[model samples]
Target: MKALFVAGTGTDLGKTHVACALLAAARSRGLTVEAFKPVVSGFDPHAPDDSDPARLARALGRPEAWAEVSPRRYRAPLAPNLAARLEGDTLRMDDLVADCRDWLSTRDVELALIEGAGGVMSPMTDEATNLDLMAALGLPVLLVAGSYLGTASHLLTALEVVRARGLTIAAIVVSENLDAPDLDQTLALLRAFEQQAPILSAPRAATWDADALVDTLLA
Candidate 1:
């Protein structure tokens, strides 16, 4: 029941990409792996192609059903709490934690990757945030960030918050952003926190060895 929560510095920061890479690596080693995105916004169950849950389902070799991967979904492409409100629904922090625990109890896998919606501090419910959920789960975090101009600031701010909450950070994966500066510069900017945790880079549109990333994470 080894689990890690894939959290991002901001929306679309390659959290799913990293999660899928880890899932693929785990599967290659013949390890049973499961992925969950307990809450998602801007998801259409009927159209799984553009949704995070579908991507996770495909990575895990499971059917692309929204209900299977993400228990709660809202069609509005906004924060979970706001999206839920738009759909005339409400999300309770306790219920969200309960659902996650229930799902984890049913899975017997070598690794389980739970992805949070939006950024780490994004509101999941009216009274709670993704950070609260991560604290409740009590699992190590795999923080994902983009290699954009302001990424260094965002990453450092996230690191500070994560540290303040006393959460274990398994690693930090900086996904190359095409609009950002060169990889070397971005890496250099992040090097300041190298002593904090293992910092890795994910090339954009390049062939990657998922197993290598997995090895680093497990190490």
Candidate 2:
């Protein structure tokens, strides 16, 4: 499966937004796309349409598959580990890897986008962080970051850790912060430090296009 794990610098950094954008772009190119958010927190079963998995499902044109897209869900708006603990359960890295493998093989999914919860350092379980999961999955990473003040420090720190784990960064997407849309400045700062790999922008626009990002991914 041609898969890319979408991870964020921190929570609410637009991982799902970029993933959905990529999914839309891939679909527009006539590729069969599928998404998996595996572990989701801050989930309300009654209002499932507003969650990350729901957005991804809608992007993939499979709105009904939202539940399947994110199986380990918790009601509390906490980290996955904390949320799972509240339900008297635990998240196993092995189980996660196995489930992902199953999802990838279940269909002829041309492009599989797996989105990680929270930041790379966010705990998925007592013993595993998102970084460990990314390493285990061995897929290219699409690191999503914000365009807010102090974003440079946060984003660079995330990049250092991800690279230290020997993970291939497919791209770094600087998501436009609505409160402070310093997108161009963020891109410029990121470019100054990051000489290699593709660093793109996710401007908050109604007509936001993902064609260029998709082109880089397909290349």
Residue 167 alpha-carbon offset, candidate 1, angstroms: 0.5
Candidate 1 Cα lDDT to native: 0.87
lDDT of 2 at 58: 89
TM-score of each: 0.95, 0.96
TM-score of 2: 0.96
Q: Which ten residues in a row have the lowest lDDT in candidate 1?
A: 204-213
Query: Candidate 1 on 1-219: residue-level lDDT in tens?
Result: 688999999999889888888898789899899998998999885787878888888889886554789979899999899999999999999999998899999999989989999898999998899999999998899999999899988999998888789899998999988878998888877986557788888876645656767887776
Segments in model 2 whose C-alpha atoms lie over 4 Å from true places: none
Count steric clashes of candidate 1: 0
List of clashing residue pairs for candidate 1:
none
Those runs of model 1 whose alpha carbons end farther than 4 Å from true positions after fitting are none
